[model samples]
Target chain A: MSLVFDMALVAGLIALALHVVVTRDGRGAILAFMAFGLLLGIGWARLASVDVALTEAAIGGGLTGMLLLRAQAHLVRHAAHPAALPTDRRRWLVPALSCGLVTLALAAVVLAFPRPAPSLAHQAVASLEATGLGNPVTAVLLAYRAIDTLLEKIVLILALVGVWSLSRDAAWGGASQLRPAIIPEPLVFLARVMPPFGVLIAVYQVWVGADLPGGTFQAGTILAAMALLVMLAGLRLAPQTQSRALRLMLAGGPALFVLVGFLGVAVAQGFLSYPEAIAKPLIVGIEAALTLSIAGTLALLVAGPPDRAPEP
Target chain B: MSAIALTSASLFGLCGAALVGIGLFCILTHPDLLRRIIGFNILGAGIFLVFGAVARRGAAMGLSGDPVPQAMVITGIVVAFAATALAIALLRRLASLTGSATLEAATPPRSET
Candidate 1:
């Protein structure tokens, strides 16, 4: 039954992928891609990567889909008719042949991946006690691989800056207006109904992440989604990008992460090193702060750069 | 060779390889910037799937998969989203300024009808 399921999933995944690639309309392709993300999340779960599954489903499917959908809506005015994409089907032939060969090579290589597949599972497990985390993946993320997580957070910040800078200088630091031209009654209702539950789920995911498959990324995404829903529903105003409180929230996680890293040098072995006795608390603290920053960053990212200047 | 090598891990790994191919084809053949961005994500997901397969095959210590790779995949997914958002931002900016979504440098920007 399981093997059959996997086969069906793979078939479905491939079909959706092809659909996204060939769909002439941008919105259709994006919606298909969102479905693809959710399916891929399930695929990750099947592979026993629960953390990855959550992240894929949340960020990959939920947030990215929203971003693309909004962008598509904005750009559709330019393409009254779908862009001339399917002109010559034969044009895909050469590229298709090339991609086929690449796939063949990759498949052969994957099949031959050294038996017993080189892995860090044991090392990750061995160091788990030091991190005071039950989930080896969380341990790997916050303990053994602290620097990567730190740098990744900074990368997100930098990307947001890049995104924000694209707006006109006068509109810089303006408020993100998520109000659609005509708000649907259902969306407004959803916005009112959903956020309370979403917040609780997000908090639960982060709080228990140290021992489970949930973590900051997934939690952050859920919070981001909820925040977006509220703003989109026009229940609450989207915060100004230049609001000091918003900026502080956006940078606080990484800032604390950096401070903690430097504190490691004074208190423990080196940067980002936690005293074993307090490791879990420290990791969780960082995660909690990071979750807030990530949520704000991601929500604003999807809401996109500020469009209108703040009222005087 | 491990007996498990012939299991679902290998199957999904092969599946991932196929996705990478499809993504590459989309990126190369599609004229639309939006489709190309989506293609980039498909490519990233394929690579992560391959990583997932590796993580699963290495399961040990009562765990179902390797923690290290799973952590990496989680991080990769977030980063990929960040990059995608940036790309979409750039694309929208291009569309607003030039009135064209595709970057055909030799040709003039599409004039508003």
Candidate 2:
């Protein structure tokens, strides 16, 4: 019976996704896409990653939905109606063959995972006491592979810069008709109640990240969602002529990450080796900074241009 | 079989694959910028489902759902959001600059004919 039900849900999810792809109208497709995100969140929760589920729901569904909707609205007013979707035969065949190959490759790899391994990940977990962090993943991300995490953050910043630079020159005069409907009354009420809860949950996740399956990235994503919701309600933030605060927020994560890594070098005589004496407290501080930075980056991404809209 | 575990794992795997297939089709066929963004998001959702499956595997092993993979998935989710937002921003700019909402029709590269 459980298997039957599981299969049904999975099939439903797949059908919905296929509908989104096949749908010709861009607006309808986006709505279906948001529904797909929500379903995926439930799927994550089923897998025992409540932390990931929350992040997926908030960031994956809520924020992405809002941004796409806004862009759609903006385009509708400033540009000609989109042409009919392409129907090239080669396009269909290429994706079908490529997806098939990718799926088969993935299945082959997953099936090959050994039941018994040399257990390097386990060894890393067992030796977590030396890393000064309570969460094994945090220990891995910051202490073991600090360079990778640092570079990832830099990639994020660079992505934002690239997008901003590309879009800045396009003159999009305000189309009064382009504004999305005002935040609905029920949605407004829900929004008010939700942010505080989101804040509480985000804080709890960050604090327990040292020992549990929670962390700054998940918490920060939630926090960013709360802010994104408030901004999307049509309350515009004033644009800063100078991006001093933006610079600060963008630098916050990598700066804290580098500072902590250097501190490790100074005290432990090795790169990224946090001092055993004060690992927990220091890790907490770094996580806090990370949360702040993540929230900032996500908010700016949602806001798009400093010229179009500002985060109030 | 733990009822909850048995049900959720299979459901996630099936749903994830479906999403991936549809998303791929949309991405390849759709010329509208908005539709492409939607497709990109669907693809991300499918990947999230895969992560969920791995987490369920951790549970069946009698350990708490492994935090490492979960953490990485969460990171990926946030990054995906940023990427989607950036893509939408670019799409809007493209729309405005070319005054065409469909991407394939938006710009025609110059030729030395």
Candidate 3:
């Protein structure tokens, strides 16, 4: 019975992905892509990775959908006419055959996967207790592979820089107005009411993440979503791109992580190697800073480059 | 692992394979930058799903899946989002400046309408 349900779910995922690819209109494709992300989240849950499922739902489906929709609206005036584009039959043949071959090769590899798959689960679990993290995933992220997490934070910052650099010279150091000019009453009402609860949940997710599936990424995404909602409803505006506080918030997490990592060289085994005595608190400290930075970076990423001149 | 679980993993894996194919086709054939970006995301999702299946197969020591890969997937999702945002921002800027979103080769040097 469970297998049947899983099969159906996989079928639904495939159908949605196909729809996303084949849809004629860009807007339609984006909507389908969002649905595809949600289904992919469910697929992750079925595979028993709840942490990934949360990230998929929040960042993959939710934030990405918003970004794409904003882009769609922006491009509506300049968008190419799909009907006017030439669609020759011969243009499809090579791509279709090559894609088919790639799919078949991948499917073959999947079916032929080793019977006793090699894994790091045992190694991860064995060393997990030393890190004082209940969640093995957390241990792997913050303890075993701290460098990856640190670098990922840098990637977010770089992406934000890339986005801000796109702004015109006059708009530099200005506010990114994410909200539409017109606001509806119900949205304003929800924005005012939802954030308090969202804040609580975001904190809870980060706090429990040391021992559970929740973590900095999921928690930060929730916080970003709440901020976006408030901005969309005109309750607040995105911070100016060049605000010192905003820049500090964006850099604090990674800077702190790197500082602690270098400290490990003198205090522990190597860089990022937390001393056993203070491991838990140290990891938690890093996560706290990371959550704030991630929230700020994500919100600003979606807000795009500043569009308006700074208020004189 | 249970036979049922194995079967489900394989099924999902195949589904991911198909998604990768469709996304690849879309990326190759579509001229519109937005569609290509969407296709790139689909391609990424497919790759993550395949990795998820690998993690599931590695479930042992009383864990549901390999925590390392799961952690990696979470990180991958964030990075992918950042890349998508950058791409879209670049696309928007390109459209604003060039007044065109399609990236087809300008053989005839078509003028912006």
Candidate 4:
């Protein structure tokens, strides 16, 4: 029964995916892509990685949908009418063949690979308990090799900053004033039901990660999803100016990381090395800050610059 | 069960690859910039599928599963989203400045588009 269900879901994904690819209207394609993300979230859950499942649902399905819809609204107003894409163009033949060959080669290589075995991931899991987190992934994220995750957060912030700077002088600020978008009644009903429980689930995922498949990333994703739902329903408007609190929240993760790292230097010999005596508290604090920061960064990505709302 | 799981997984993987190929075709053929962006998103989804399959394959081992790749993929997805947003902003700006609805066709000069 489970296998049958999995097959059904995968089939649905492939069908939607094909539909999305074939659609001439970019807006319709974007909506299909969002649906695919939700299918992917389900795919992950069925595969048993609850953390990934949650994150996929939140970020991949939820936040991404919001961003695409917002961008599509602008593009539709500005772009040409939908027409069948030109497929008779012969000049693409060589590049197309080359890309096809490359893709086939990659698929063959993956098919030939042996089953995975224990290594870095296993090692991380083995030593995870020492990190004062219940979830091995969380331990891997914020403790074992937290430096990588820290830099990643910085990357997200930098990307957003780059977007803001590039469009800063342009007519990007009128989306907030665009004609009030209508939210379908069904979606409004669903949004109201999902968020409260989603909040609880997101928090539960964070709190029990010491031995389970949940963590700050998954939790932040859920928070981002809630924000996305609100945005989609027009319950919230993209701010014309970012609030002071939003600014602090945006900088919170990096700031907290630096603050905690320096404190570690004061107490220990190296940066970010929590003293054995207070490791749990330090982990909890850093994780909480990271979660908030991630949530803010994701929300902003979907919201874009409140300053650049394109006039409807 | 494992055999069926592996097969279905392989099938999805193949579908993903096919999607990537079609998306590339769309990118190469479509003159509309927005359609090209859609192509890129399709391409990314294909790559994401490969990563998901890798994670499932890892489950076969009696290990606690590697969080590293999954973490990396999650991080990559977010970063990709941010990059896409930036691209959309730049593309929109480009569209407004030039008043050209078909930047893809104009760029390569008798090339792909």
Candidate 5:
């Protein structure tokens, strides 16, 4: 029964992906990709990676889809002219054939894998007692692989900078205009009603993440979505790129994270090491700060580079 | 390939391979930068799913998948997203400057105001 469900989910995932690639209408393809992301999330769940499934759904399906859709809307409304695609029959065949070859090669590789696959599961769980994080995945992220997480956070901040720098000189240090020319009634209502619940769910996820499937990425995505909802509905202004507080919020999590890592070198085992006595509290505190910063960064990312010129 | 296996890991592994093919096709052939960005994301998802299948094969210690791979996938998903946002921003800027969304050189240039 479960295999049947997995088969069905994979089938849907493949079909949606095909539709996204082959569709002529740009908007329709994006919508299909969103469905594909959500289905892939379920596929992850079946593999017993619920935390990944949540990230796939929230960031993969929800946030990325919103960003693409917003970009589509912006391009459609402001393009100097409709850019027509060159339809070349010969151009299509090479990519199609090459990609098919790649797929067949990869499929063969997967099928040839040896039985009794090698893994780090035993080591992960065995070392879990000291970190005090019941969730092994969380341990890998915040404990065993702290440097990667810290660097990833820095990468995110840099990406935001790259996007912001794309703005015109006059619009530098300004805010993107996210409000629609006319707001819809339903959007306004949902923006007003949804955030309270979204905040509660995000908080719960961060708190339980040390012991369960939920964690900072999923919670941050949720909070970002709620903040986006309010911004899109014109209920709240998007932050100006020049705002001092906004810059601080964007950098706070990683700053605190680096501070702890250095402190570890002096007081604990080494860089990013936690003293066995207080590892849990230290990691949890890091996650809490990260959650808010991630939320702000993602929300602003989807909001795109600022367009409104700074006040004279 | 020696007679195809029916394990869930193998099955999803095959699914992921096909997705990579489809996404690569889109990226290589699709003219619209935005659509290509979508293609890039689909390709990322495929690669992650393949890794997920590998993690699943390592299930033990009361965990369904290896924590290491799962953590890596989570991180990959977020990084992929940040990269996508950057790509979209660049695409929009290209459209604003060139007044065209595609890179093909044959499209006739427009007169500047």
Candidate 6:
């Protein structure tokens, strides 16, 4: 019975994906892509990766859909012509054949996966106690492979910089207008009602993440979404790019992570190696800072490049 | 993993494979930059699903999946979102500057002989 349900889910996922690729209207494609993300989240749950499922739903579906929908709206307003649909018969055949072949090859590999698959689960579980974290995924992220997590944070910051650099000279250091000029009453009502609960859930996710499936990425994204909602409803203004407090919030998590990592060299076995006695507290400290930084950075990224001139 | 679980894993894995193919087709054939960006995201989702399947098959020691890959996927999802935002920002800027939403349409037209 469970297998049947899983099969149906996968079928739905594939159908949505096909629709996303084949849809003529750009807006319809994006809507299908959002649904695809949500169904993909369910697929992750069926695979038993709840942490990934949460990330998929929040960042993958919610935040990314928002960004794409906003971009689509912007493009519609700026471009005189709508995107042209591919109508040439000669263009279709080769791509279809090649893609089908690639799918077949991958499916063959999946069927032939090695038995008694090699894994790091035992090693991760064994050393998980050293980090003093209840969640093995958290231990792996913050302890076993701290450098990747740190670098990923840097990538987020760098992407934000790249986005900001696209702004025109006059708009540098200015605020990006994220909300549409005309706002609907129901959206404003929901935005007003939703954020307090969103904040509570975001904090809860981060706080429980040390022992559960929730973590900085998932929680941070939730916070980012709430901030976006508030901005969209015109409850608060999107920050100017040069705002001192916003810059600090964006850099705080990564700065703290790097500082703690270097401290490990002086106090522990090596860089990012937590001393057994104080490991849990240290990891939690890093997560707390990271959650804030990630929230600020992600919200700003979705807000896009600065558009309004500076208020000086 | 049990037989049922193994079957389910492969089913999702195959779904992922088909998605990658579909996304690649869109990226290669679609003229619009925004559509291509969406295609890139679909390709990414497919890759993550494949990773999830690997994690599932590696489940042992009472864990549902391998923590390492699951952790990696979590990180990958965040990074992918950042990349998508950057791409969309770039596309929006291009549209504003060039007055065209697609590369093919952006070029100057040739005069008939």
User: Which candidate ranks first by DockQ, i.e. highest?
Assistant: 1
In the predicted model 2, the residue pairs found to clash are A134-A210, A135-A210
Worst 10-residue lDDT window for candidate 1 chain A reads A78-87
Q: How does each model score on TM-score?
A: 0.96, 0.82, 0.96, 0.83, 0.96, 0.96
Candidate 2 lDDT tens digits, A177-235: 22246667766676677889989999999988877767777787788777766555544
Candidate 2 C-alpha lDDT tens digits along B9-103: 54575456556666766677776767877777777777767656665555422344655566567667766776787777787777778887774
Model 6: clashing residue pairs?
Answer: none
**Superior candidate under DockQ, 2 versus 6:** 6
Docking class of 6: medium
What DockQ results do all the predictions give, each relative to the true complex? 0.59, 0.39, 0.58, 0.37, 0.57, 0.57
Candidate 5 residue pairs in clash (backbone atoms < 3 Å): none
What TM-score does prediction 5 earn? 0.96
Which regions in candidate 2 have their CA more than 4 angstroms from the true location? Answer: A84-94, A108-113, A116-121, A131-134, A167-194, A234-243, A308-312, B1-18, B51-62, B105-113
* Interface C-alpha root-mean-square deviation, candidates in order: 2.6, 5.0, 2.8, 3.8, 3.0, 3.2
TM-score of 6: 0.96
Better of 2 and 4 by DockQ: 2
Worst 10 residues of 4 chain A by lDDT: A171-180
Candidate 5, residue A18: CA error in Å? 1.1
Point out where model 6 deviates above 4 Å.
A82-85, B1-6, B105-113
Fnat per model, in the order shown: 0.71, 0.58, 0.72, 0.33, 0.73, 0.82
CA-lDDT, candidates in order: 0.87, 0.67, 0.88, 0.68, 0.89, 0.88
User: What DockQ results for candidate 1?
Assistant: 0.59
Tell me what TM-score chain A of model 6 achieves.
Answer: 0.97
* Candidate 5: regions farther than 4 A off: A80-87, B1-4, B107-113
Per-candidate total of colliding backbone pairs: 0, 2, 0, 14, 0, 0
